[model samples]
Target: MLNLFSRNKQLLDEEIINWIFDSYDWAFKQFDPSVFFEETELVLPTNQYFPGEQNSINGMANLIFEQVKQHAGMTHWPTKLLNVTESEHQPVNPATLSVKGQLRGKQAQASFELGSSVEALSEDTKPTETKPAVTKATSTKTTSIKNNAFDESEYSTDLNLVMSAGHASEPNTGNNSINFSFHPQQLNSPEGLIAHFAQGLAQHLVSAAENPPPGGKEYLPVATELMGIFMGFGVIFANSAVVPRQGGCGGCGGGQSPVRQVVLNQDEATYALALFCCLKGIEKKQVVKHLKKHLRGLFKLALKDCERRLKQESRLSLSFAS
Candidate 1:
């Protein structure tokens, strides 16, 4: 998965991370995913700052930015705009406060503020209690998933797809889980998954916006996997859904836009889907013990934020049934 998500292609800015959590918070309030599966359109309360849109999930990238800005309370955030405040805050020397230096400093600070939330989350998720050693069963599962190689060939056209619901309690007094998996494929590799990222995002977003995929009898389990991949660490799951891809940067990059270069070919999208299935198991793995402290902060903030959202919502049956 690290190989798939790959190198430093711009860090997920702090604000974007916050928005992701907020989206989770919103979904949690409606029910940890009942609403996600039930409704195609996502809406949020309107306020002076971030008035979420009627179709927040699948809108044109530019328009969504306005909604995100409003929600982040950073509507005044600059776009191709600059301010003067050289590196030292107060220019190292009054004479050094040239327009260029001042602008650079301000720009740096502005960018820092933008990513504050992500850093905060990273800090908060840091480990507190020491984690127990990985049990043999857990280690075995990890090895099996990673060692399974993809079927790469000219004739390998079919994806090995499986979807089924867990057996319900015979008494009908318990819930069941859904499981879906695909035979490992080339696209699940570092090179292939990276190649399909852009196209997969375009397809997913467009499908979500213009025409949602048919659900039929397979909806619940499939939807659960999608939500988990998206909400969890998102290594294999960070679809174009990335804020920058949504045009969140202050200014557009020059030269041919990457979006224009990639043709949204169906083959590529299909490949990505296969990879998504193989990567779906990432959600269940526990964080590595050594790195748990670093991630604890993120877990903490996400929980705190969800709790806030839950508080705003009416109490659900489970909360008060006792």
Candidate 2:
């Protein structure tokens, strides 16, 4: 009975566990191992990680995008290739018009009427002065940085790897530019926006792969979410996975329901986060406080499970030889 209980106590099932492990291994093979072992820091949802205030919504979104890109280890990614715009549905504001005609002259009056009509059309076509909402940075040059620690032969052979700013270059995606449309509601929760940006960037990385992840097409979304976790944004992802909605009126009998934002559920995200902490040798005390109150217990269990699994398999250990 005790053994059965122990077996059932596992946080994730065997298939999910294998998939996570396989994904991590594949990531190590694709990108630099130092990213998982040394370079990538466990990002937290705090002012220390994201600082600065942009009064306008567009400015805040831009700031978050840049920070997420940096944390995902893609600072070398050309800013010109990406565009960020707010998704809004607003009614068209038509301009008012008034026309007056006088029956006094002949050809000259007709020509004057034509000229007035043309001027009115031009005035109507003039662009309106609205608040800046779309944020996109343009540059003619792409910067590349070289790292002595990176090994060329070890990574994927399908695409040419250009070492850039201590990380890999942004994947070449044909002619289409990457665009992120964020809802204005996201500004209320910066963590969710960070998770969204991380996942978006991760999708770009996943697209560059020669082959699909372990489960192939069907699991692509899951793999993309995991890729975000693998990119060191696990904390933000886990925290933003499920957010409680504001309750409605008491008489209406409406209760609070959590909004599911990411593909991974709370437990899965926390487990993946634990896997990250385990491989990176991050202690519980370092990351536990940042997680939600309800998730702290599960995180502890996940940490223990990850530690046990890693002990059984020595491949993920980090013991450098002298």
Candidate 3:
């Protein structure tokens, strides 16, 4: 597996990295991803920034992921848009402020400020029609239903598909445990799976081309791996955070956009799937370990932010008492 990584990893990564960095250089004339994912720091009387940096981190992660997902395989997605900052407080140098950056699922091309929050948005339209499955010849085939009236056996098969898709559960269950799944829709055809990533690759070509990063060659392998991970992760579980997996992201909720927190452990399943797709290897232990690593990264970020907020609160209390 490491040999496989060593052999083709450079090509995979460099392709993604160059496209991203080049796109940014070509369009904006300035290589800054923050133009798409940026935060404005407001000057508070003591030292409190509402929404906080952690919130900024979370929001930026989501924003980058959204852009990567939508345009990751697009042919005509825009690479640059106007940069406008709207904030409550004025600062002398806004560019110096630190904010998180990511290019996960899709790119956010347009943004608007609504009172206290900033919203970056993009649009995509995919054909709703399902692709026809290719029929392959098999030596030993199950009996096909003749032009049917109500066939009990046929009814059983369809029912099984429904149940399998909806009722299957992960073996392990806990607060942080991931619910393992193999979506029936995807499992129906290998061609469908191939086409899915083909579309994704096309989307990423456009996305990375339009929104290239400054990291240069080092960026591609990680970005490709990241995208492969993102795609693979979407496959192993049915969730809304990463992609519109299991059609869960579409439901209505207070007219607000769906808020999905991709469980970090899901990345293990994702890594396994990507390897299977890209490298054709499956190691269960490796999958679990990768998932744990992703979870640790997320937990570390969340914990660090929580610590910072707590310290801020403590300092405020002392100041008030004084």
Candidate 4:
């Protein structure tokens, strides 16, 4: 179980909450109140460690499921979850599960392209890969300071490896001049977390479009209501983590210490990138195109894995009932 120690756990929880509020604030700014208030309620799952007993991953999942069902016109919930047969005592790591599933509702039948980078969109000309120059200053009288160039190549290599594994790229999709890159590093960094939350917002959008809940037009307002929740909370988390604040320094019993609290490590960035990719729409044609260019066999294997998981789940549930 994840431990909540010192103020770290509390801070992380607050950060997550702030992200939700920031999302809401942004929506209200645009004159959208549906998110803040809606008579209808949807059940969704939350993280297991969420404060209230009511707030859990299962709860959040249920909430999202209900919203999607209402939008999709699903009269009942998908109670038949893929029984996580894996050991609970062990550290929770979904990726480790050799088991994979492809529920009919969650299957990716479409393809998507990456948006251009923000820099690319703003600048008239495309950015050419340029190396940063490094210089060392030598002074006998003073400490010799070496202005070492940032190892951008190292960063690029790591980012490239992940992109290659995930098989995502910024292929201009249309007139949607949105340019963005899911840098694994950024997910942990100030910008990365914003991007991460944005990815969640994107996921909500994709989920809404792909899996609308049981309700018809009645829940549209509520679904969109979440937009503000996402924006408001996102901004707060980003600003609070990035903007430097002064506090008492340890060295001087009472001295000014400048510090930026939130930091995004590499792992977080990779997760964020995955989220971004998940949000991107995949067209059937694009999938076929990719198959033609890449290892067609592995693509089939991945799909087969999805099919096998769904079948296995169905079988397990049936066995339990019998």
Candidate 5:
């Protein structure tokens, strides 16, 4: 009967804890552990990490994307950005002022005649050569499409067509471009945008892995969320995991509730964050101030739990080695 008064101390289930450790080990193996041990920095929401003005949504998204890419060590990957809106509305095409750059493997000079219609003519096919309107040449082989106006609807369709034609024309040159799409609402929430970008990039990293995660394909989403934490965006993900929602009473403030938008819940995300901090040897004081008021206690609990767990693992490993 005395056991009824005893408190259960574990924050997460045993299964979840094992999955977190196993997935983290997989990530450590996939992306060099040396980098995680010595290089990766915990990305904060302050201007020091995300400097500059928040003037345009696209501009801001691009800036954040670059920062996330740099922190995640994915700077070398070829990528394209697309701001996708709701599908119901008619999407206008951004104005394409110019298209310049050489096609891969073909020495043919192509000219685009633009006025009422757009046409592409090769040097070998055209009898008369007209001076190109806009010509921007680059040493690297890339198709540059400059848009005076930013529009998502037409741009998505046009880019797909261009990419498809390029692939059809030259199938040997592998297309390695990754397109990242953002919703219109994401611009308002910086932390949400960061979480989305981190997850999107993490998905790419997972897809490129030689083997599946610890629990296999079914746990892909959970693993991806954890991988984002491993990429140094744990603070962002943890804080933005649960968002408060107002009831349908409008200004009456009658029915207020909390909604879980992302895959990981508050406890899971906080525990993962604590795991990240503990593994990196980061002190709790450095991270506590950044978390939500309620989560601060949970984070502390998670930190202690992670530390104890790691110590046990270390002891076991030493015994096995001996």
Candidate 6:
């Protein structure tokens, strides 16, 4: 069903792949390798389409996905996830006022205080009608951001609404699988993607703590590992179609070119990785070197695949010979 000639299809596939890689990379970085290397066996479902099969585009797609799984996998998350909570404190204060007014025949007066504090924590007695009631509240929100820092609370009256709305939409919890997705727009926001991935890690921590899978290990922060993941993903899919588009220049009056290579230059790709690392809370010089080091064999593999695809396409004339 995938046709490269169809521009829309190509774009959609590219867009989906881009986000998948980002999420996979993030999830992988948070994974602890010890779980995978443990004595237990990891039985990955076997259903990959072999790219070498004759006229099998599905095989190629499956191969690409498998490569991504291999490239992105790192550790086994615990059955439970860590707890990262955000608390809101809404403190309301009100002072009552009384006023008397004269009517045409009889004097009438009414006064009331709106938004009076509702003290729910203290065991104090209520005051008389002459004084206004007051309430006090203290709250906290803890999450694994900026090195598990304690950030400000966003308290509100509708705690449920605020809690659910502040974070990204969660995946279905009924199924025993880690599944999440992103809109094309969200892929552009590395910060949001990182946050969502952190939420996933929190889920894993909670699962681990609650279930305690066999040989499950303690959870720890892996900022550097995350950075390395970004580097790998950025370098591998630097030309992500999901990134926001800017003005593109061709001839002022000319029509579109039949073939256009919109790939980023080397320097541009490098800069993009650096920007992502800075955003992800890693701004060290070694980041780039680490990417280069891990990427030593990437170009070679890419070249081989390109050559094979070129040969395959050249030999095919739409269908197999009778």
27-133 per-residue lDDT for model 4 (tens digits):
23332233223211211111221111122222322233233333222222112111122223211111111101211122112222222222221100111121111
| Predicted model with the maximum lDDT | 5
- TM-scores for all candidates? 0.22, 0.64, 0.21, 0.21, 0.66, 0.21
Give candidate 2's error at residue 195 in angstroms.
Answer: 0.2
lDDT of 5: 0.56
Candidate 1, position 78, lDDT: 33
How many clashes in each candidate?
16, 0, 23, 59, 0, 17
lDDT of 3 by residue, 1-322 (tens): 3565445222123343333323323323322323222321111111111111112322322223223334332212222211113223311111111112222223423221112212222111121111111111111001121211112321111111111112222122222211111122331322122223333332233233334434554444334333333233323221112332342222222121122212222333233233222221233333333221333233233333323433454422221211
Colliding pairs, model 5: none
Give the TM-score comparing model 3 with the true structure, all chains together: 0.21
lDDT of 5 by residue, 200-251 (tens): 6666556445567888977766777788898788987876565433321211
Report residue 313 deviation for candidate 2 (angstroms). Answer: 2.4
lDDT, candidate 6, 13-79, per-residue tens: 3333243234323333333323222311211111121112212222222223233333333122111
Pitting candidate 1 against candidate 3, the one with the higher TM-score is 1
Per-residue lDDT of candidate 1, residues 1-322 (tens digit): 3675645232234444343333333324422233223221211111222222222111212233333323222233232110111122210111110111111111122211121111110000111111111111101000012211122221111221121233311111111110001112321332222222222222222222212222422332233223323322132222211112232331232121222122212222222222222222212123212111223234333433334434454432223112
Best by TM-score: 5
Question: Which run of 10 residues does model 6 get worst, by summed lDDT?
Answer: 154-163
lDDT for each residue of candidate 2 in 96-122, tens digit (9 for 90 to 100)? 211122111111111111111111111
Candidate 6 CA-lDDT value:
0.26
Q: Over 4 Å off in model 5, which ranges?
A: 1-6, 86-176, 246-261, 314-322
